[model samples]
Target: MATATATARAATMARGSGAADAPALMLSGVGKRYPKFELRDVSFALPRGYIMGFIGPNGAGKSTTIKIIMNMVRKSTGAVKVLGLDHVALETEVKRHVGYLGEEPHFYEEVTPAWLGGFVGKYYPTWDARLYKATLERFGIEQSKRVKTLSKGMKVKLGLALALSHRPELLILDEPTSGLDPVIRHDVLAELMSVIQDERRSVFFSTHITQDVEKVADYVTFINDGRIVISDVKDDVLARWKRVSFPLPLRPEARSASDPAGLEAGVAEARAKVEQAMRGALGRAFAAYKIDGLTFTGITCAFSEDVAREVGHLAGTRPRVLPVSLDDILVAIVRGSEAC
Candidate 1:
């Protein structure tokens, strides 16, 4: 009897034996609409073995998209597939191979981690009690402690352990590191990285923390106003969105003095006459095609490639280049959100 129990446990906790072939997730033209907001035509895919970072502002429809993919919410249009199964028609089937963590994870009011983990373990066909036990110990979660008694960081750690113990092929996490302390967050990230070492596994996470994304993401998708602004290799996006700055040689007021009392009249005339011309020129100069489908809120003289070229046109010299970071891109997106 002892030998039989040991054999069964070994079989149950076996790793890397499932998920030989399949794209972890697939989304095509997915969208959801609410009374006040809509998740516009959003689409992306996560192949097995690659980590995709979902990045957006606070209300840029990141949560809505994840909910749709998880089949927790209905999408007005588009298709989603998880582990080679349709998210809607095959909801149960798809759920079998996906593990998810919400931004704010809530547990049963009175249950303890050990009990809760065992409770959730029953739903999955391939739950590994040993893995769950190991993870809890690694994260320093006191399994006997009640759910309500755990701190915010401890809750997140427990959530991750639950998600991983199922041995799912795909993991989808929404703001998993949002409010955790640095020490705990580092532990969570480190464990997640280890879990994805198998090339058959993948992760899709949405976060506002660029540093975290940079650390583990192989691909990045930038969403703004419920639409995808840029989805490409992380390096390519960084290279394309640049910042440039140059000193203003002289103030405009100094040049204004060269004119007469009618100088104001001339300036107003220049403004009126060149408004359309300026727009037309800008449209052509910055590969206008990129902005065609995108609605812009505002385009200022950013220390960017666009601004560098403009400064060059004005001063007949190349402007100094300023390094642009992901924060800079996100800030620009926020400043321009209204137009989109």
Candidate 2:
């Protein structure tokens, strides 16, 4: 598999497709509501020839959003456009140019890969039998293997081969690497990177694996609790967020207090003070915090010198600021949302 830096460089090289004026996929005010869960006002776009990672924890509505975009699930409110065409109004036409790989793909259990390919190939006008066979062989998938007999990784590989054989302009993959072993996952991602080499094609990758997103995505859309937390270039997002840690001052009187009520009150007061200080300095900044014994850990987007100085003053220690990974960012976002 290509290194993350190499994948990112490839994505950057493919970023200058002529269709810069319009996005490959766009969603505006997209919403879907359920009795216990909802996707609200989700909006983002994937440019032509670039890869966008759609990231979120489980039940964060990533699949719901994809289904809405595919017109498989109706949206309560929103607009979806694919290749500049309204997805609902141009469902058939949109599907012709879009290839989708579901998290759990289903096929006729008794059918062999070859039979399945032949049946599915009829629906795609641009299906290339040679390419299909080549891809299958590359993945080491046997054409005569029955769907039920194939391992989970093999099934995913078969899905990818089928999805790519038609040479679709847009590819939408949901949890493509979820259950595969590391080697298989790397192979799958490498294939995706190769696909993005075409300046006319784009990919919308939805997965919980932050490492995968960090590896190849040019743009990232992070969602949690059915809402978009952040969306921007992967590099910018990484540069803008940070992890800040500091030592918390414990009140000696509180620590020495004999009465349980008094101790609880004192500790609560100290916590309230810390929170107030943080709020005063950050002012609704995207952040999450936790107290561990005498230490305070915070994940925030305010990594500037001014913010650092302010935090140092409040904590009576120079804050330790560290660059964060996409996985850390996701955890922080989810924790911040829960804190709210």
lDDT for each residue of candidate 2 in 1-340, tens digit (9 for 90 to 100): 5698677646643542223346889999999999999999999988888999999999999999999999889999989988877898868767878889998999899999999889999998878899999999999999998899999999999999999988888999999999889999999989889998988799998999999999999999999999998889999888778788877654778778999887777767777778787666473444777777556787777567877887777776788888899999888777754332
- List pairs with backbone clashes in candidate 2: none
lDDT of 1 at 56: 89
Q: Report, for every candidate in turn, its global Cα lDDT versus the true structure.
A: 0.73, 0.85
Error of 1 at 242 (Å): 1.1
TM-score of 2: 0.83
The CA lDDT at 83 in model 1 is 66
Which parts of model 1 are misplaced by more than 4 Å? 1-22, 249-315, 337-340
